[model samples]
Target chain A: MKLSIENLNSFYGSVQVLRELTLHVNTGEVLCLLGRNGAGKTTILKSIMGLVEHNGSIMLGDCEISGLGAHEIPRKGIGYVPQGRRLFAELTVKENLQIGMLIKGEDSHSLDRIFKLFPVLKERLKQESGTLSGGEQQMLAMARALCLQPGVLLLDEPTEGLMPSMIASIRDVVLKLREQGVGILLVEQRIDAVLPVANRVAFIENGYVKAEMERDELANEPDLMRHYVGI
Target chain B: MDFGPFLFLATLEGLVQAAVLCLIALGLSLVFGVMRVVNVAHGEFYMLGAVLAWWITGWFAGNPAIGFVAAIIIGPLLVGVIAYFVERLILRKVEYDPEATIVATIGILYIVQQLVLITFGPDARPVDTPFYFLIEFPWFGYSGYKLLVICAAIMLLLAVWYVITRTRLGLVMRATQYDRETAQNFGIAVNQVYAIVFATGAGLAAVAAVLIVPIQQAHYLMGRDPLLLSFIVVIIGGLGSIRGTLVAALIIGLSDGIISVFFSPTLAKMVSTLLVAMVLVFKPEGLFGSRSQL
Candidate 1:
């Protein structure tokens, strides 16, 4: 599966956030979006998820999903894990996962696979998600999205305030998902942690893609990364 | 009248009032709980149900039971259909905004009242009880149908509890109540859920009206008192808590019945209103309601 975007423009009320932004993610690859705060990295993901109004087309493997409602985007094979780990705080961990299954009509057997991925969730299936720790909530969010079994996953700052050990665990989960051939569009500010998992890095500034570097090129050229991302 | 028989009668009356109030306030509570939209026209839906019951019974020449049965089933269904349209057309247009929906519902209250007055006429009408058998108490006989209303209310409340606890639809509603954006992202159609919740809430109120129209005459303006009482029940019970609504309904209903029987009906209303004010001043979250995040 591939997600291709061309000339995407988004706005919040009258202020423009994303201006003619273009990017793509192929199956079995992880594309990381790196940028400063208020740089429109999250807006691009929101635009793809149909959460925000946008002008350009978002093609998810031949189908244009830009005009679809936010709820319809997930059914069209695009899963989204929004910023702040927007879990249903009052709902149980299991019920939160069940919401995704209800939409896609997937069976309970897939839950076993998810539980294997996040064993802590299995033990706390009946517990309310709001009571969980930050790392646990992040795991629940990712697991909830994965329950959709989408072709492409959009993650916005999955490890924003996690501890070091929790960050490593999240990084490992992303790498494992990559091995399973789920194309991932990850937005992150922590370059050191995301560098190991990213297949290619896209530096965005002012809602535009400033530079694109392959993994080998990023490893070889530290000055180029500093020049574009200002890291 | 002897005090013993009078006390028994008052308790029975209280139970009936509690049953009806539970049904009405449950609808209000569920709507507030899920959608956070205060339906100002909720009482009109009840009045519509009663008016519809009177109309449906008018068609049958004999056997008031047939009319009663048909009204109980058809009243709620018709109100549910009307509510579905109202939500999709009016409430949905307002984006379910708290203040906007309140104004829209108040407009709906007047519209429904005027429509009923014009079509159903301005007279208050009574529905005959389905059965005439009376329950023989030790001192006096009591209406068997009133007792049946209490039993039916218990069964219906149990059914509602089961649906909320065991059904997938309930899970979807709870998830939506917790976080609408996340629920939408997970592929739950939030708009569709809102429409369904709105319809169901109206239907529940209609059911209460159908059950009570036999005792209380159906009038175009009768919705006013029930609306006031239901708001009081919801407020004292906690705005959006179903369990709180039920408990508060019982407390208000029983006290109203006993006080009305012992003293004056006006005193009952005054005392309940005072209690509501006290609850608001002290524990705004209500006796049973937890502090809501939203």
Candidate 2:
């Protein structure tokens, strides 16, 4: 399903973080949000997940999801893997996965797919999540969200501190999700990682969408990143 | 008169105290751990359970055992329902803000205490034990009912442990305790979880009171000691650590029983308070809690 946001203004208390930013991700396409720190890229994802106060139309295939409670939003076929992984640290890997599956509301046989993607998670199922390595934790985070089998997935900085090999695997997973027809909105700092997976790049500056371009066109222009993202 | 019998008696009394205190403190610790709010009225829920047990048992004039059995089953359930409303109305309204909830629960404490004093007539009422069989020891006779209380507490603790470790509902609670926002993101009804947890906490406190009312009189002010002791247990055990709570309860309960029996009740309270101060000074996160948890 298509996910669309129009005239979305989000705020944290009195500090307005997102302006009238408009964006959308079509089915089976990965829309990457590229921006510097304090550019409100993360806020955009939070607003769509109804985790922040916002005034906007967040339409998931014409169903407005803005103003919904955070607990209610995930049940609408959207899975969010927030920054820092945010796993229940004390809980075991199996229990962490169980929380995600609880949202799916049924045993949808997604565990097999998850295990196939991250075999290490199956090995460490009984191990505490906090004890997992950073890469394993990220994989578990992605695997936890994937348990939802969501129509749209919002990932915030999934490759923030990963090794190059792990980043490549993340890219492969993103591409695979796109192939499975899951619309993805990925927030990333590395252009190299975004290039292969993101179909379209939405350049955000100061809570506003400054520019949008096809991934190929953006890859061709090196100065565009220097201008909008300052990298 | 020998030291062996006295020590054995003290140990037995301590075990009984630890059994009931663990149940009460577990509730307090769970509520504090998950909701991040100090339930100042936790003791009042305990008092209410004892008072309710007395009131409910007064109905069956023929056999006190029949009423005692009914009190054991119904007392905590009623307290849980009341606690559910209190959480939804007062705690939820305050947004579970730590400071606000403390004030709100203090208000709940006074309201409940005063209401009990007015209706229950400020008397230290007693409930009959479910059974009156005594276990004859070498030197003295011990109440079989007290031993039963210890067994019941163990069983309840085991059930609670099983639920938290092996059940989906328990996983949901732990997830909420870890990160409320993330839990909500996973479609866990966080507010509902808060209500359930708060009620369950109060229910546990009430159960402790119901079990102990047979031994101790149900006084409006009876909540004070259990409240203080359980708080000590929760803090000493490490705020949210259930394992720590149980261990701390045994230590505190046995010490209280032995000290009160040997020296004086006031001295026992002072010693426990001193221990709390020492724990706070030495280990702020508590004995079992990690530094990061604080």
TM-score of chain B of each: 0.98, 0.97
Q: Which one is best on TM-score?
A: 2
Off by over 4 Å in 2: A105-108, B291-294
Name the weakest run of 10 consecutive residues (lDDT summed) in model 1 chain B.
Answer: B285-294
- Per-candidate Cα lDDT values, in order, are 0.89, 0.91
Candidate 2 overall lDDT versus native: 0.91
Model 1 stretches astray by more than 4 angstroms: A219-230, B1-5, B291-294
lDDT of 1 at B138: 86
By summed lDDT, the worst window of 10 consecutive residues in model 1 chain A runs over A222-231
Give the alpha carbon lDDT tens digit for every residue of B1-294 in model 2. Answer: 798899889889989999999999999998998889899999999999999999999988878889988998899999999999999999999999989999999999999999999998987898888789989998989999999999999999999889887888988888898899999889999999999999999999999999999999899988888899999998898998888898999989899889989898889889889888989999977888762231
Candidate 1 residue B259 Cα shift, in angstroms, is 1.1
- Per-residue error at B7 for model 2, in Å? 0.6
Clashing pairs in 2: none
